[model samples]
Target chain A: MTVSELAQLDDFEAVALPEADREIDGAYSGDLLSWVMGRARAGNAWITIMSNINVVAVASLADTACVILAEGVIPDEEFTATAQARQVNVLRSGKPAYEISLILGSVL
Target chain B: MSDALSFHYDVDGESFSSAGQASAGVKKNLRQLGIDPEIIRKVSIAMYEGEINMVIHAGGGEADITVEDNCIVIVLTDRGPGIADIDKAMEEGYSTARDNIRALGFGAGMGLPNMKRYTDEMNISSVVGEGTTITMKVFF
Candidate 1:
């Protein structure tokens, strides 16, 4: 499912993703940066609590469909810009990564 | 298979947060080559684990990536106190990392096994006082 569809399934208060030139396919969730770096598939959602800019680097490395910042975390200005530059969909949710993972697993 | 392209990286042992930089770089290069996502993931994940192991156990280390015709080989060499028992070290929940390393979201003892899991073949060689070297491969 797309991040848009996943957003609709739960009360996320999501930070809407900018319109992308490509379509999304799947979802992946993990807190371990290395695990996500290795396991996250391209065209998939990368939901995590990591707030560092390196997280964006990892997202780029994995070619993820989007990055969902869970648990009400906020990204630094550099992060949003980097994600945008990479054309990665970046979003934020009021809920935690675990809760978002549950909704995502069921929805997508 | 020949036509090997090699790359080298020095893992920083002091920084827990920077552990996966080499793996990240390799992932980007693989994507640019239009490699299969599954193969890329396997290579990246295995290499990431090995990188972290180097940072946490060894003071730091070097990683070499050789991309051949049909497979990618990653060699991670570290100067940490080597594993005494290879079999025991391979167990999933066995970790010798300090409490500090665990706080950084690693050292759950899955590093070695995870590397083995994602790679097509893995070889680990070490001496107790010397160091450890892990060589892993992912077929294209």
Candidate 2:
């Protein structure tokens, strides 16, 4: 499934749209940007509570399809803007990280 | 042979928000140069890990990237309190970053290992009070 398709699901809310629809091949749950950068797959949904601008950078470097901010963690405007500029998808979810991971795993 | 294309950047120590700017810029440059996408990703990730280290441990530093026909070389230099043990520092899950840094989604102690893992070659030189310089090469 693509990031846009996943975002349109009931649990996720799209905060920023990527320049294109990147396919979601997998999912990774981590708050450590460095760890995620080193471990996450190219087309994964990065599930995290990190709402900082650096999150966008890490996501871009890891080539993750989208960043899902779980537990309704809202990123600042600057972060979402950077996400848009970087062509990264950002999604907000009210579910916990584990639940989001499960939901993404079942679908992707 | 002709000299390789190069770019230099000075990373600001105070801004976590801007830590990966140099790497990001380098990635763009590599893309413009028509480097292979896989090689570009490796070089960018390795350089980015170095930049984060400079910000978290060295109070910032300078990054120099040289692109050659066969490989890309990155040199990162910083003058912060140096690593006492390179071996330990290279270990995963051995971070010395403060709790605040961890709160910012870093400090997982995977920086050096990740840098080495993504690159073809890695070297480190440091003194206790002086600073550290890391050289990494990623093959194109």
> Top DockQ: which candidate number?
2
Chain B TM-score list for all models: 0.96, 0.97
Error of 2 at A7 (Å): 1.2
Clashing pairs in 1: none
Judged by whole-model lDDT over C-alpha atoms, candidate 1 comes out at 0.78
Q: Give the per-residue Cα lDDT of candidate 2 at A59.
A: 86
What's the TM-score of every candidate structure? 0.79, 0.97
Measured over the true interface residues after superposition, the C-alpha RMSD of each candidate is 3.3, 0.8
Candidate 2, position A19, lDDT: 45
RMSD to the true structure for each prediction, in A, is 3.4, 1.1
TM-score of chain A of each: 0.80, 0.96
lDDT of 1 by residue, B1-140 (tens): 45678889999988765767898788878889898987887788788788878888888899999999888999999889998999998997788988877655566788788888889899999998899999998887
* Model 1: CA > 4 A from native: A4-44, A52-64, A77-89, A105-107
- Fraction of native Cα-Cα interface contacts (under 8 Å, chains A and B) also present in model 1: 0.21
Q: Clashing residue pairs, candidate 2?
A: none
Q: Could you tell me the TM-score of chain B in model 2?
A: 0.97
- DockQ agreement of candidate 1 with the native complex: 0.34
